[model samples]
Target: MTGPVRHLHLTELRARVLSEDPAALEAWEALTNHLANVKRAREKGPRGFEKYYEACRQGLHRLSLLAGIKGISLYTSRHQFAADSKRAGHSHPQTAAEMGHASDRTAVTHYGRRVQGRPGTPLPLPSPEEVKTVRKKLGPSNGPHREQK
Candidate 1:
């Protein structure tokens, strides 16, 4: 397997969806095509990228939409927030708090509750019954094949 794909930039993203310029390089075209397969068009769905559950190639590209909306790449925002918080002297305690919460398996639960009120995060986590139903549908053979053979 290869490394985690580095996210793309706004200019790279724009050059992709709006591939009208003929002077664009071959590398750009290749990268854009790869993105097209991984990242669904914004016109398609709101997730920015659809997560495929199979091979590594079948992955999501959430940064595209996030960068577009935030007017800055996710990494930049992450760094910016860290820098700001550090300057404000709130970074250490905040990081520790987040780390403490990280161990809680109720991870997305709190997150979902927050945005459940908004149009965002419409689908809350599946209930136990819902999970059972999905398991029955897939059957044991169709389970995630992550075991070392």
Candidate 2:
């Protein structure tokens, strides 16, 4: 649900429902929209919504088992989405926004694996002597007693 549900998924569901009865579009749409309980359930509480979500998850698991698919779950799907986004030449920030991440760092750290052996420029580090020279120049004049003097 993070990304748009695959069109194939919707197509398959529509096919399955129509196979049972040709005139089930309204019924299918009702189910898809959860219109049956939408208004009434809001007044009741979120327990009904939670129960529906769990049932859908269980159904997905059962369907995966029936199809002989292993290791297909929400996490794997999300990981694949992130990996695919990276492969498609999207920047970390773009991928992060598409995947609903708050920060690009999360996308980079978790999903953006750097290509090994890629050459890059290294940042220059100042030498110890340079640091000491800077400290000496900034030290005595900036000291507390200098203000009094």
lDDT of each: 0.32, 0.47
lDDT tens readout by residue for model 2, 58-132 = 877898999999776646555655555555444444444545554555554565233311122111122333223
**For model 1, how does the per-residue alpha-carbon lDDT over 59-116 read when each residue is reduced to its tens digit?**
2235555456434343343344333323333223232132232212222222212112
Worst 10 residues of 2 by lDDT: 140-149
**Sequence-dependent TM-score of model 2:** 0.43
* Model 2 CA deviation exceeding 4 Å by range: 1-44, 112-149
Best by the TM-score measure: 2
Provide the global lDDT of candidate 1 against the true structure: 0.32
The TM-score values for the models, in the order shown, are 0.20, 0.43
Clash tally, candidates in order: 0, 0
